[model samples]
Target: MTATTTTAPTAASDSGLTYVDPRAPRFGQAITATVLTAGVVLAEPLFIYAIAAILGMALLSGWRLDLYGFSWRTVMIPLVGPPERREPAAPHRFAKLMGAGFTVLASALLLAGVPLAAYLLAGMVAVLAGVAATTGLCIGCRMYQQVSFFRRLGVV
Candidate 1:
């Protein structure tokens, strides 16, 4: 696909209108996968700190984009060239919410001393991230769409 650079941190969509970097969430997902992997393997119960950071970044990107631009995606844009490929931000925001909710619950479980449940929850997040990072299948986005479909069908 052809690409073009813009002065803005993100780029326009298929019609060249406002949108977000398709790769930003992928990069974030990879980082997320690594973080969750660490939490699972080390048994340090560090989910609160790490997941809180991810949730904060996700919130920033979803609600406070001026701050979101400070994230790694923006930092790497110069080396990677402006992100000309774009997608709707709504689904990504939904995905982030899902991830945040999962991590928060995982953190709470870790605190409650339910180690098995905590690891399983965190493992789900890691698998979701791994799917996005490796296969580009965003389970969260799929779930968002599914929910939207059900809502439209008056079955939600």
Candidate 2:
């Protein structure tokens, strides 16, 4: 998902929080779920590696550099028009980083010859992403919010 910086007029939110199109994260999750599922189902390292690379870029740089976000802005938006609302960008960003960590760990497991374990991890991530994409209930994002809350309460 793309973050609404001060420069993006369309991304401005009344709360002044960084915002993202409400649909972008869901679309990104859909792509993520599909890619991870394909990697496990097809037993293809290439698919996993490709997703790993994409997520790595997002984790290292920002969601603005993510291929999924780019695709959403360039392709999906053109076909579907703009989203009706925006959501806080931090939770989605946290989710992307968490997903990246999972993929990276899965890739390592695959490289270490633990294919079953790798597939299981990737499959779990796929299921989580699928749920998020279809239902707009992001577990990782929820986890982020909870963690943030706990941190604020000095309970983390």
Candidate 3:
């Protein structure tokens, strides 16, 4: 007589998908951020454009464009938690990095007396992010990989 062995699969293996796909989270964050940013643009009285841009970056980065909280529990509540599989792609690290960078840049510009530039950059970032969300492409992630490859060769 022989006994059979049974093993439980881990969540990562159970998902039957890679942990990082570089598109899904970015798309979800983008959509969530855009809606909130649009509200901010409409309600805020000053630096509307610049604020909008900064908010746009927040949307792209999966961070709260608002200066309130910075936890996944907080960020994910309204952004990606509900409707669990709306976007199937795993969040790309590169997209998150770029989104954070853009958000910071826009914020600095807003504070540095370059509201127009901030606004424009933010608008462009938002538009590109929106397009990517709709079309399932991540320009930021592609650019990051390209730059990383060159940097490894000391070419910057």
* lDDT leader: 2
Considering only N, C-alpha and C atoms within 3 Å, which residue pairs clash in candidate 3? Answer: none
lDDT of 3 by residue, 11-119 (tens): 1222554332223355445653574356346643243344345445555645434332233324443454333232212234455456656655766776798867766
TM-score of each: 0.81, 0.89, 0.51
Clashing pairs in 2: none
Clashes of each: 0, 0, 0
Q: Which of candidates 1 and 2 reaches a greater lDDT?
A: 2
Query: What are the lDDT scores of the predictions, listed in order?
Result: 0.72, 0.82, 0.49
Pairs with backbone N, CA or C atoms under 3 Å apart (clashes), candidate 1:
none
TM-score of 1: 0.81
Compose the digit string of candidate 2's lDDT tens values, residues 30-112.
Answer: 98899989999999987787778888898888555778777777777778877676778789889888889988888999999
Where is model 1 poorest over a 10-residue stretch in terms of lDDT? 1-10
lDDT of 2: 0.82
